[model samples]
Target: MIRVAVFNFKMLPTRAFDRFSLQIAISGMSNQTDDEEVHVGPDGTFRPTPQQAEDLQLQLDEVEQELHQAAKYGLYLVEKNEELWQTIERLHVEHETAQTEWKGEMKTVERHLYAAQQERDAWRLCVIPLSLRIPLSSRKCHAVEDEVFQLQQSLTAAAAAQITMQMHRRGSELRRSPSSDFVGSRSVILQSPPSLDIDLDVLKQAVDDKDAQLRQALAREVDKDAYIKRLQQTKRDTLDIIQQMKTAAAMDVDVRRSMEARHAALVDRLSAVQMKLDESQDALQTRLEEESRLRDRIEDLQAELRSQGDDVDAQTSAIQSMRHKCARLEKELQAVSELAEAASTSATATDAFDRLESFFNLTALGIILEHQHRIAQEQLLEGSSRQTIARWFREAVASEVPYHAWHAWLTQRITGKPRRRFFAKGADVSPSSSLAKAIADFFDKYRHDKKSPKRSLESANPTPPYS
Candidate 1:
């Protein structure tokens, strides 16, 4: 039995059973079966004693316990492997989700970056023209200011000459009929040159009055010049900011766009203001010319009055005509004054009809409307057939369409709807109806006529019935 147990131990897998434990079991079995060796033959075949059998059984039980312990350990390993595999699968799923989220986030970032780039490009484009226009506009404004200054100087000179002439007339009248108070006071000194003393006093008073008036006019002109200079300076500062933005490499799109819009608005306002100034200058020039003509006529009449001193009827008629001319000039001056006041009071009212009462009186409105209609007709006729122009003008007037609306209609008729740039709004220079009306009025009143080449529009055109 001991030999059989040893043989079984040898036959057991070395990898599954401990060699040391197996040796011990075999040795113990051998010790028990030592006495049983008497049954052994020389060929090694033998039977065991009862004690040897018990020892063999005990070794078998010990081997079985070790085998059961190894199987339990293997089962524990298999369960741990299954847990590891589950963990790996869960980690893989998490990694895939993370990758998908990263891709989506990247796409969103790319889309936003593309939009920002496009907006930046649009602002850069808008800024380029504004930068270029600033210096040119400033130069033009300076030139206009120079012209206005020259016109003012000439007006002052003319006024001075007129005052001198008036003084001369007053002196002559004083010499012809001295004041009773002067005669009574200087009766004794009247022996040699009675009129000389009175003439001196009258001339002195006239000169002082004229000088005061001239000073006041000059002061007003200076104030106006200063105001204009201030406006120009502000405009220059705005342009400088725009230029700086243009030079910069990058800027916020919303800020750039707002600045661009503000610049455009400023340009439009400046242009309108320039137009008003030009019109005002022209009106001033016309008034000066008319004053010159009137002065010459007055001088001629004075000479005639001296020569025909006894012809009261002709002199009265001449005086009446002069009075009428003076009244007309005064009316024109009042109109000019009103226009200037309107312009100075508000920068927003660059277009006509913004303040209807400020621009057009009850008497002037109809004639202004007629003149506007004529201008519209002329403009239309220049490009299209006369029949079409006439028809359109007539229809516009009949419908009581505002000038801006009519201009838009005419523009649409001539050209298709105005094209806009990518990411840009409508055309910048589209004329307003009120602006058209204002422009027509300005031209009608100030533009020189083809006929009577030497005459101004105010002189060449027939006076309106209301006037």
Candidate 2:
């Protein structure tokens, strides 16, 4: 209740007359007795006694002090309210400035995003057409796409570098002429024109250099062709030697000596080729190292450009567009290089495979010849007759050794046939021969007699089992 009364009192208007009236009323109430009687004056009108007048004066003084304090408080509150309004206005202005800056940044970001999307769509269009036109395997297609992505990265990095360099140069120029007219700066840019012309000249120069390099590479490829022809000749010679060795496996002269000599010559040629290949590899490594150094420098420039500010984004994008075209050309060049490398690798692999096949043929021929030679030696040691040997070889050839009973049949033929003999009875016979014949005849007659008795006994008691 007290708080409500205080609030209501604070709500009252701060007027001097109202404060005086309130003071008068308070003085009257304080002077009044419990019966509500009042002092009377001589003229019969109401008047204040000395105590009442003193009390009223004191109340008026207190009211005046309170009014003065309220007036100071109101003045302070007014100043504070004005300060708050000023603060509100300042905050509103800051918010608007911030919003404007944010909007500008968002617009810039949106433009960049839109441009990136467009570039992505353009790349897809290019790749889709290329992929559709070519009849490449999936692996090759993926490789092509990877190469494109790498080229894009390289081009973007190069563009970024070019933009960064240009921006630095522009900043320096601007700094040099802080008070130069805008028209004057524009005139200067038109006069020098550092961007496209310079890039074109550089590209042309690079193309000329690449043309020279390609010519050199072509010369190297010609040398490789010569080497490949030599290898082919060697292979043909080796095959011929193998055929000769097969035909004359049992010849008196040794064929391995000629083969060994040819193998040594092939090894020498291969060693030379290997040396050449190593030299080429070393050159490639050096070139790649140089390229890596250049790439590193480009990255450093890009990093510096990134540090400069956000203002170069549009210029960077324009540079990238130009570089994308350049990168397409680079892609074709890289494809050519890759094709050449692949051809070289395939040729090498083919050569190796051919050499390996030839070696295997030679090895198999040697094994067969050695086995035949060992068999001949064993037969000679066993003192096999010439006729027997001839028969064994004839039978081995006739058997054809396939489909059935090769081992058993060959073994039976290799063991000589059993011998049969006949004697002439009219010719004069030696005494010993006659005596042996008589003894043989007597034994034969005795054996016949013994068999007759046994036959009679069997006939008389024909076995019960037989019956």
Candidate 3:
């Protein structure tokens, strides 16, 4: 039975179970010493007495059962650890896939937005009211009007010249040929007839033809006057239409301005929504970092288990800690999902964001203030005179420097970024009102204190006085 137990113990795969079996054998042997002595065989081979053998066999059976149980438990832990690793890997892969999908979705959305913007611009151009598109220059209409006026003047002049010429010719013909009454009177006065003879009928026929010519000239003048009046009326109508178009164009300008304002508002809202999405992405990144930390912790636990498999309590505690971490991770994941959903739905979901922002703001403010305090202490420790330190702090508090200038100055001091040759200034460059206010409050608290002392003095410490 002893040989069989030894063989079974040796055949066990794990060192942990082997150690456990050795511990069991040592305890059983110790119990035998308290109970009775083992009998030795004559051939120099040791043999246990009957009671010792039975006790030894029973102990071996117990040890084997324990070894088997330990092996099974170890296998279970290994499998669990593997499952955890697989879960972590799966989660990591899912995170990467989600990020890729989100990026693709964002790109697609941006493309669609760009296309929509272009389409909107195209529609704005294409669907513009005619009033807005009305030609500003009336050169063509002016040229037509000028040509019509010139043509009317030329026709009127021609008609007048023809009438004048006809009148002149009639007057000359009447003068050359005397009237019938005048001829008769002249013949009576002369007693004898003159050598030249004048026919009265022929003179009357010439007078009638002249009268018909004058009538035709008057008709042509009347026709020209009527045509001129019609052209003038047409010109007046065109002028009225142009005036109405100009008024409509002015109204269209106002409408276009309003539409542009609305478009600008929409663009601002879109930018706000994009900012929200960026915040959610930041949250996701934080979750990934947490997951990485958890993975590292699990790997540490696994190493611990390999090195000290006997420490079951430590393993249980590590597993419990992992469970707690996993729960936390789950909660974080849920929060990230909520953030993303809110960001997608509305830009107005600022209440929750404001709370988060406030928390981070306070944390950052505390860090900055602490850093500045440490720097001040170091300066004092470096033997800077108390008056000089006080003067520097006073000067900083009194200066009217803008937040952006302060930010740039700090950035240069901390990161060694180079400045431009000429300082670029803008009104809307910086709006970290919270940080600025925090800084201002910090300064205001101790600015009035004139007692200059060393860094060792608690009261002289240049620290944030806020709770």
Candidate 4:
């Protein structure tokens, strides 16, 4: 028993259980402790192997720490449930009270409902007339209409901005082109005729003068300003087109929606009218049946009167009833006529749509061209300042022409690519021949440009040789 207690001591908690187990072992008694955290007794306690018992106690301690947190969360949820239950009970009590009140008012409500039913029947019989009717429109239409209007406004503003930018760019370009008083720069100086063959001293003076112009141009940043103006204009145009597209987009989604709403309202009106007509027809049918039965009764009464010697009171009452029946039938027929007209009109109005604008408003070439121009400026190129001219030339041309090829044609020269690349097998190609051909083509193009400059911003009219 002492050895058994020593082995069981491993299951102790807080090291204190181990001490108690040691005492029990020495005393030769197996007794449990009073602590609630751990109960070593046989009842409500699991006995484990000594190794298992030690592991279980360690796990329990870790779980107890976690339980502290879980208890708080559980308590919070439990409190919430209690509050919710209380609220539900309160609402249930209020509902019971309302039900009692409703029960008390039921008689009055039934009286009103009966009155309405009689009134509706009278309308069917043409005794009471229906004047006011609901129109086919939705509350949501107002909300969406405002948003579409705003989008249209924004698109219009964007287009205007683009137009302003274009005007400014043209103005600046006009100013820069062919200004006799304008000074030259290193860039222009380098491009000047290579035949100058001036001695180094004379060339140096021209270089200095050109350098001064370059400095002035740089400080003033005319190129940069022009570039900025062009870019802004392009962006404005794009944004405007996008705005117009947005309006179109809004209109597209709304077109169906507005129509649907109108359709729904019209359908509702149509349904209401149909219901009214059905009611009137049903009443009319009933009246006709009654009149037929009355006619049969009158015929039978007349036959009886002829057989009887005296029946004046009965005859008088029968005649009055027959007249009332005829009058009721006439009223029903009128009601039926009115209801049929209303139904036909409703069907005609609900089933059709009317156009508000001329056909093909969006497909106009001018709008498409402006739209394409704006998109190209904003998305394709960046910060060239020559964006208008550059983008137009680039996209308008055929894709088969390479960019370098165009540039080579423009400059009347090619570098970084020597003519030797093109060859007859085992034979050397002459650079002079390639150069000569290029020069001839350049003159030809120049002559064509002089005849008339095409109104394309992108196509360069190489300046005509001064006559």
Candidate 5:
């Protein structure tokens, strides 16, 4: 709420006036409506609300809180009676003054709006040439029509020229009519202008030259016949020389001389070889006794093998009769094999990943360790492939690594057919380092250290279930 500091308290209704006080009391005791409601009239003047009333819809509770806050700053001045009449008249005068001032501002805005509208109209007019296209279609049609008319004119001109030419040709043809008497025509042709007389000296010379050429032609034929015989003689001499050279080259004695030393050496070696062969026969005779004894043992073994074969046959028969049982067993074995293989593969992949991790870590550790290898030392410091210390990855290959079977398995995994050339592929991957290390580790772990081991691959125990 706002009020003038030097309020005209003299204009206020009498404070002690019991009649007005009673009226305020009566309203306060009764309905006791808002002061604005009670004082509102054409002649009344009221103070503004303490808070600036914003247009936003806030909760009543927040509005009240705001109002309470606003009330703390100042209180509204209340009044009644003719004093409000004078204030109301003054407010009306002020409102008129504000309206007049606003009208002036609105006129300025209107001036700007009118200018802007004019500018917009000018811009639209300027853009008319762009958006409001005068279609090329009508102009194009006119141009095409003109072109066609011009072409027709050209055609007419060309036809006229042709007809004129034809008329001239027809007139000439009529003048050149060949329907004349023969003697008269001959006489006219002979008596024509001197221009018709062509020179005959060149023709007379040409006839004499032809007669001379006929004589020369006879002489040339005789010369050609003689030359052909001489050419045949020369050709025969050339062929004779070529044949003699070929015969001499075929009987070349140099090749025999080249083999002479080798043939002598062969003769000497043959005698020595014969003596050695005699000694070899003697040794073979002694070995034959040993072989005979071995043959007896082999016979006994063959007998045993035959017995075993019979047993095996019986077993085979039994297995054949129990076809379903064998099939089930085989399937179970196959399933077990597949499961084992899958597990092995998973374990291998895991182990490989683990090894790779460990390998990198160990590599890092080794970098921290003393430097012995050149590559490793370089790789450690550099971090970059050029700078980073690296040894062959195979250096840390485990002794327990399996090579052959794993190679076979890997081959099976990579290619549907089992490739025995994995060693070659491995060689290609890292021949000097990883390949050697892997091969070493695989051999040490999977193969028996003995010279020989009598165990089939399938019979061997499975790898443990760990990476």
Candidate 6:
């Protein structure tokens, strides 16, 4: 009841006459001894005693002074509230500006992080393949060296065999002509022993055959020398390639190290930026909470002021708008955070793909290197043999035969089969005439003459026929 009466008192108009009348009525009612005692005049007006009227006037004066003081205080509160609202607006604007700047910085950091990841991935991809390739190149070199060594051994055996055959022919001649000096000037005009009855024409022909055999052997020796030189050159080339591969590997390692250092720096920078972003976000959250609380306080003050019949509806609507704005800003911040996270994840995936690409590139490089090495080895092996064959054809086969025909004939001889055609399609040689058989027969006669003791004797007994 007292609370209701105080509310009614505050709701009353600040009028001196009205307050005085209310006081008089209250005093008259309190002074009544019984409920039946009359407190009102016949004219329906409250009649008070002189003391009650003076006391009511004094009470009226006090109430008017209190009302004036309350008005001044309310006005001061209104001014302070306006200043507070201005401060809140400034703080909200600053918060929004800071949030915008933070988001920009986050985006920049994310881009940097992504670039760093790509570089790091590239480094990893390049390094692993280079690391594996070094050993493979070394192995290829070793294999090439082994193959060259084998070729050299075969060439050496061929040379030794040729030397032995020459020595055997010389020894056989010495045995057949017991009195002739093998290397003296008199041996140039050889004479037959008394027991041998050889015809002059037969001996001369035999001597010509032996000379041809010796020439053929010398030609073979020359071919061997050339073949050895070619092998040596191939070996040198392979060594140079190996050295280059080593240099490339070393360079790759250095590049990888540099990239790693750069990546580490970027990671540190990214981490620092992330930390700062987190701190900014946390500070923003705290500020938002504080702002929310301030808004609540303002809303409470506005409610109180509204209850007191103050016009604060416009201010309340502005505060609500600010709340909506703050909520929107928070959502934007969350979206930015999600974007940063997605960027980070995408960067990670990009790095993985880069690594995979590097792996594939390395694998491709390795395959290419293997293919090149194989081709080089084949070329090295075939080059010397082809050169040797070419030299043999040039020296042994008369220049009358075209190189293609000689090559075909040689191939047929070595393979022990007839060729489709030894000469070009339009050649004058009949199809029935086997060029391969002809070459084989010539080589057989040449070999037989080289081995025959009669030929050796005729060659060693190099004297002019008995005239």
lDDT of each: 0.50, 0.48, 0.49, 0.44, 0.42, 0.49
Return whichever of 1 and 4 wins on lDDT: 1
Write model 2 residue lDDT over 113-206, tens digit each, in one string: 9999998885565444333333343454456456555655665678668777876897788778757566788677677657656865665565
Show the colliding residue pairs in model 3: none
lDDT score at residue 24, model 4, on the 0-100 scale: 44
Residue 432, candidate 4: Cα error in Å is 99
Residue pair clashes in candidate 4: 227-385
- Model 2 regions more than 4 Å off: 1-31, 34-44, 127-467
Model 4 segments beyond 4 Å from truth?
1-221, 248-256, 305-467
Candidate 1, residues 1-467, lDDT tens digits: the string is 43333444545676544544434444555445343443454767453445754665586678678777888999999999999999999999999999999999999999999999998885565455444555665565566556555655665676567657766765665677657756643454345244554655665565566566656656765675576566567668979998888767355766789899999999999999899889767755654564354345434434543454454563354334434444554465556445645554343222222222212221122222222322344442333332444454545445555533544555444443321231155323311233335435544453342123323222222222221
How many backbone collisions does model 6 have? 6
Clashes of each: 2, 0, 0, 1, 7, 6
* C-alpha-based local distance difference test score of model 5: 0.42
* Model 2 per-residue lDDT at 107: 100
The candidate with the higher TM-score, 3 or 4, is 3
TM-score of 2: 0.23
| Cα lDDT, model 2, residue 205 | 68
Q: What is the lDDT of residue 216 in candidate 2?
A: 67
Q: What tens-digit string does per-residue lDDT give for candidate 5 at 370-458?
A: 11122243332333221121222232233333333443332332233354453555533311133224333533433342122222222
User: lDDT score, residue 308, model 3?
Assistant: 46
Evaluated against the true structure, the overall lDDT of model 2 is: 0.48
Q: What CA RMSD would candidate 2 show?
A: 51.5
Residue pairs in collision within model 1: 403-433, 404-433
Instruction: Give me the displacement of residue 267 in model 6, in angstroms.
Output: 47
- Higher-lDDT candidate of 2 and 5: 2
